[model samples]
Target: MTVAVTLLLASLVVGLATGLLFRVWALALASPLVAVVSAIALQSAGFEFFAGVSVIVGCLVVSQLAYLLATFHLHREKHSMEDEVDGLPGKHRQKNIRDQYE
Candidate 1:
């Protein structure tokens, strides 16, 4: 496949996997760099380097959009969970280890 097509596919897969399955913000954030590196590695000698760079840039933008969409859903889910937890009667509010005082 051409670098453009390959970059598109790779970025989409990585963005979706990291954003949906892993819900890892950092990884999702790094997907653009990953796409760029993949393009560099997989690009054909006949492919124009400037064209490959443009493809990578396009892929990066799409991946970031995908990541934002996924993270928006995650934030919604998290807020819903927190609301549910806060609705319990007689609850003192839940705290994680990070919130606990030593």
Candidate 2:
């Protein structure tokens, strides 16, 4: 009950941070690996097999969904900014901050 909710919330935070902070898609592998480890730990802590499995699945689903959502919004933001920049004439174009750093 309480433990499941706590785990789900933690998973959500982790997923969102991963998506927002790390652009590499390959980093999502952490979710599955963590899920398996959590399941095993729960079983060793006296949880039933089915209960532990269910909790792990829930955490994985929550985290992955959150990661997907954050990434989608990030793309949307980037694309929208690009569209604004593209409509400007070359003489009046804003210098991108990224360009300066590069």
Candidate 3:
């Protein structure tokens, strides 16, 4: 029970930290953090830390890959829309509207 809760908390923290890091650094950092946390969890649980670390690293890799994939997909969609619209069409027209409150 304690192990399960710890693992859950660790995973959330790792995910959030990695996500923030991804915004600035590179996504690859998540794997190492996941591995280290997994090792600690395994040690506390009386299991082989290496194997647990490997599994956690795999999951982190998958998560980062998914994040990258989704980001690219969203970016592409945004650009496609931008290409269709070109830019704001009536900027000068809107600017010409006189303010009545002078």
Candidate 4:
């Protein structure tokens, strides 16, 4: 029981961090599901409760960090793309294409 509770709390922390990193409130709301599954899987695998919690927390942190880094990279790529488009020879042509798409 204690192990279950610990795992659940750890998962909640992970979920909260993920939600914050992604700015997605829905992820935070779904944290309990993550916790429950993690607990079950860890128990089935014969890991102690604390160890399972530690592993879950570590995974969560790493995943959230990776997501944040990816988002940053994507934002940078988008900005660079926009700049490239802006520096093209024909501004009117770009505007026309944007308008057509819109």
TM-score of each: 0.56, 0.64, 0.44, 0.45
Error of 2 at 7 (Å): 0.7
Measured with C-alpha atoms, the lDDT of residue 42 in candidate 4 is: 79
Q: In model 3, what lDDT does residue 17 have? A: 54
Question: Any runs in candidate 4 off by more than 4 Å, and if so which?
Answer: 1-23, 29-32, 78-102
Number of the top candidate by lDDT?
2
For every model in order, what is the number of clashing pairs? 0, 0, 0, 0
**CA lDDT of each candidate?**
0.66, 0.75, 0.57, 0.59
Better of 1 and 4 by TM-score: 1
How would you encode candidate 3's per-residue C-alpha lDDT over 21-101 as one tens digit per residue? 456254556556656776666777776656565556655655565556555655663455434576642444335444433
* Count of backbone collisions in candidate 4: 0
**Candidate scoring better on lDDT of 2 and 4:** 2
Those runs of model 3 whose alpha carbons end farther than 4 Å from true positions after fitting are 1-24, 79-102
Tell me the spans in candidate 2 whose CA falls farther than 4 Å from its real position.
24-28, 78-102
Q: Give the per-residue lDDT digits (tens) of candidate 4, residues 1-86.
A: 45545555565566545645555555554444565677677778788867888866654554455545555655663455545755
RMSD per model, one decimal: 7.7, 5.4, 6.9, 8.1
Return the top candidate by TM-score.
Answer: 2
Could you tell me the lDDT of residue 62 within candidate 4?
Answer: 49
lDDT of 1 by residue, 1-102 (tens): 465676777777677666777655677457747775767665754567787677777887777777767777777645555566556422233444335753
- Rank ordering of all candidates by TM-score, starting from the highest: 2, 1, 4, 3
The residue-level lDDT of candidate 2 at 9 comes to 86
What TM-score, to 2 decimals, does candidate 3 have?
0.44
What's the C-alpha lDDT at position 16 in model 4? 47
Candidate 1 residue 71 C-alpha distance from true site, Å: 1.3
